[model samples]
Target: MAAKTWASATRDGGQSITTTSVWSVVRRLIGYECFETDPEYLLLQSIYEDLRLYFNFFQPVLKLIAKEHMDKKVIKRYDGRAIGDHDTAAPPYQQVMAFKDVPFETKARLTNLYVQLNPAHLRTTIDAKVAKLWKISW
Candidate 1:
């Protein structure tokens, strides 16, 4: 999952402000607009996507671990669009959309993963992944 991106020191030299990602903003939007639960579909989608991206960032290490724990095919299916059930009629795949548009609980477990990751590690790790994913250099 995307980590809080911006941070600042307070007047007392303590950590002050922190900012998340555009993706996180989008997740919150999903909560207010699409899913009403605490951990929305978009959030879970972000987490799933980040997991793949970060695995690639630390290739040979985390990649192997992710491969061992998560099936390639299954992880590929974490496209956020498959949150709930499948409905292929309404918006092409109405069944899938309907399934994906359910309560946030369907995607809440991912939130636990996000909360568990250390903020410091998450930020550095995600930054590395994002940079690599975008093919940029230091």
Candidate 2:
């Protein structure tokens, strides 16, 4: 019904609307038709597409979140994308939690094991094994 009404509306200064220009305002509002040339908008669009390929289960997602605000900073940057710097400086998966507080021998041994198996594949294998051990099927 709305589309039907929009198709017959008059344009600026009482001019008849063209067939292609009917509902141009609604098209821009709903589809961001005016942002076709926006750089940040295009970048965000690409990021959204790429993120669709990444899906994973997170471990330890508990309310250790409360510990996040333990350290106060001089100023909060508000929005990461606004500053154009969203890098968390996280180490690669193989190196994550590798040498934390463990004795040199143990750390090196575990790190050697992790490196032998690629970290990404190793995580899947571990998750599968844990599921099997717990009789989890999905």
- Per lDDT, the best of the predicted structures is 1
lDDT of 1 by residue, 20-130 (tens): 444443333223232223243334445446544333232222111122235544431222333233412221122222466655664464445445655457557555544
Off by over 4 Å in 2: 1-100, 119-138
Q: Rate the local accuracy (lDDT) of all candidates.
A: 0.38, 0.34
Model 1: how far is 70 from its true place, Å? 53
TM-scores, in order shown? 0.21, 0.23
Per-residue CA lDDT of model 2 for 37-129, tens digit only, reads 234333323322222211111221111112223357332332232222452333332234544776777666656754564446544554454
